[model samples]
Target: MRRTFCGSMIALAAMASPLSAESYPDVVSTSHYVPVRDGTRLAMSVYRPAVNTKAIEKPLPVIFVFTPYRGRSKDADGKVTETAMSDNLGLRSLLRAGYVVAVADIRGKGASFGHRRGFQDRTEALDGRDLVEWLAKQPYSDGSVGMVGCSYLGGAAFQVATTAPPSLKAAFIGASDLDKYAFVRNGGITAQFNTRPDEKPEVDLATVPMDEDRDGSMLKAAVAEHAENTPMGPLWYGMPYRDSMSAFTGTKFWEEVGPYTYLDTVKRAGIATYFWGNWRDEPTSQVILSAANLGSRFLAGPGSHCVPPEGFDLPGEIVHFFDHYLKHQDPDYGKLPRATYWVEGLNGTGGYVTSSELPGVRSHPLPWFLSQAGFGAQTSGAQGASTFTVDYDLPPAEYFAFWPRPMTEHGLGFAGGALQHDLKLVGYPVAQLKVSSDNPNADVFVYLDRIRADGTSEVISFGRLKLSHHKLSLAPYETLGLPWHSGFEKDVERPAAGEEVSLSIAMTPVSLVVPAGDRLRFVVAGADPRQRNLTDIKLDPAPRITVVWGGQDGSRVDLPLAN
Candidate 1:
């Protein structure tokens, strides 16, 4: 027999009035202590309709959510006045349309008791599946469950769905990462900017109790390493990974953790999954790539992080999705379409345009070849068959000497130099370069800029490669029609210390409509200031930088030809 804890009055008071309290089902708050396979205790709170006492009734469908945030209620002063309610008010909207909602803390976070490791997708899936199994046995539960959330929670939802737990039905994963290293690490380079220096105030991992001896040791080591290794190292990677994975501990948790890694799991399980993302997002391309490859239903809209229901009509759409899957009312849900994207720069408001496929929006790859005329004003057309020498033994001054002052002031220079060109770009862009270097091995940095008429320039897109990992992956090509990975760790074949190599670099996607009369400039150099001290570690002895051509044929820039 398992011990179960019911919600206190505080929990009930926290969710007293859902937005649509007057109509539909009445919400009754309840709580429970769900036990993981390892005997670790997890906390869960429920929000469902108050049952009609007069008649015997069947069980109700439940939506189980797992989060690291506390599930306690709040007071008037915003203090912990009561047990937190489920943070997914978006999913609560579904409950108002009549479904039970269950919110739980993973193994070590919130009110749960256990060790918290980082990025443990496997444990989370087991917890999710076990919780569903437990719910099915409950008199009030109809034995059918679905999952929903953004970020880490979204990953957990997908993980649980992949298990094909009999009670698990569908999932809506928002702002998720399918490939751990690619999405967050970016070719072994951590996404330094997205993380805040301070720990999340919502949950305190330091005080969270550990369940096993190994858990305690791992947690202690991770903390010490993070504090010792400041500017760079394995510590940086371990900190974030531990913080995210510590909640769940299992193999399924790790394997199905990334957005890309879990795709096959979901497809094989025949789970109905929907992925959500926003345009202008740092990992926009990654999300698009995942959707295109997985054949999962995707929604890309305008916004930075998660698109709120009010701004992007997400609430209404989510309700429909849940209705179609949970209720089985819409047989055409999965067959409706492959992709639905929101195109920027339409209707004068930069609104959304739906598409059936990722390529429906037509990405024009334009190239702005480098020339010797200096920065943005160089319009010498194609200087085909020209060559430049790159010496890697020099210092930074020779390569980044003229980095514009505006960049330093705005912190853009840290990433790459900005070219003073004025041009409003309306599509994707790529660069092709023919190069010769004094050193056989060298890293190439390319920065794309939009130069204004007033001589001011802003860095728009950038990318990097070691020249050696140029060979594309055939796995994604064979299965999904896309490249899965860029083997950055592989060393480039030596160039005989003074040999030339023709190279083509792919940049991140940019959808800005550069203003007319503005010039588009390409800056190829040996170093990036922002990523300084990060990966692309400062070349100990600097390197020489030079430009060779500027034309459609010769080092060209590809741009999407818009309608």
Candidate 2:
């Protein structure tokens, strides 16, 4: 018989049964360590509803989550309690949804044995397979298993599934760390939050927290210390790549940290996947949707990285995928879109729309030449003041904050307006320009904004580049509708002084509506001071950057308008 869902995920969040331990009379919560091939045992917590008898009436599917933080920390009362979920995104709703659930601490973290490696080290997939196999052998499990999580947990999910674990059936990944090297390290400037290397676990897992009482204090102290060391708010952005790599990379090699580095390999894993996350999320959900055409579904949210489970219908979606893949139910995958994204701003904005691909986007690239009279998106005219040399006063960090909707609005750089018409844009916008620097090396930040006649401004899109690494990869530009930087290594081309260099910088992908009567604006800043500690880096040539157009040198921005 097909199982009937209790209610919508919205109702599930409001339900009291899973919220309190008193209501979960038949649910069993157990904690233990799961062994891996390396003799490392990961601390694991399992929650399953019990049948009257020792064995369940029928085998059940399992949902496993891998977390970096210690979920269960002992309190002063000596009671082992789940702190992560209970305090963060609780798994109670999943337990109430009638599924066996398991949460494990990645090896070398949270009372688990061994040294914690870099994020999502490829080897964790092996342990993931072992965990899935272990779950399959459990009394209540029927062999089918799925994975789930957001952010770091999502990365773990992606890492394990890419390993092609035998018993793994599906995954629900939210705000996963994919394609971040492009967005995170945009234009050679460090973007978004990077990891804190100094915040290593104070309590050594090698010691093995033997006594629950003693270890609880040690674990609590370690967690507290780690939390203190980790920066909060909008603290990290716009440093050199070396600092980012150094902090994000731990004791292990850097290659293992970014799963996107092996983009092709991960996409080939063949697991039924649901890629869902907020569009405004630092890494951007669009990256996952557009990069691979796999057997997957995309559910994009309009919020930021910290979108709550209920806000994004997280519980409902997870149940839907797990129900179909793990429980063998026929959930309708046909009605799903190649991409379903949300658009904010302007008339009747802020609701999801389905699409064959990125919604309201096409190959209609319209050029807007830079002119003194504003942007000629419809007509081209040379700006009498077209050539503006690098002011050098612009900060490098302001170029990197490309999130929280409408992109980052730091007000750094040059300004121009596309007047008299509303520009509805979706997808990546390309900025091409002929630039020359007084110094041998220069960094440029280009930003686009929406200026309603009232004078209020909101950033629409932005792009950046280091003049040295200006070689564009035509392959990605052809397919993805934006330029792919060849990186600062092999593609380094430092322009000779006063010798103009052509550059095409790709902005972070976006979906927005510029309402009628609003105008489009563009800005160019030599460097953005808004980035974290970019002033420390000895930027070359002292910023005398020049943007020239029309007279011998042409510069323009191609806005991808929804046609």
Q: lDDT values of the candidates? A: 0.52, 0.59
lDDT of 1 by residue, 450-502 (tens): 66658777656665544443344544322223233343334225455545555
Superposed Cα deviation of residue 522, candidate 1 (Å): 3.8
Predicted structure with the largest TM-score when compared to the true one: 2
Give candidates' CA RMSD values in order. 8.3, 6.4
Q: What is the lDDT of candidate 1?
A: 0.52
Evaluate residue 509 in candidate 2 and report its C-alpha lDDT on the 0 to 100 scale. Answer: 55
CA displacement after TM-score superposition, residue 184 of candidate 2 (Å): 3.1
Q: Per-residue lDDT for 440 in model 2?
A: 60
Q: Pairing residues by index, what is the TM-score of model 1?
A: 0.70
Report the Cα lDDT for candidate 2.
0.59
Candidate 1: worst 10 consecutive residues by lDDT?
408-417
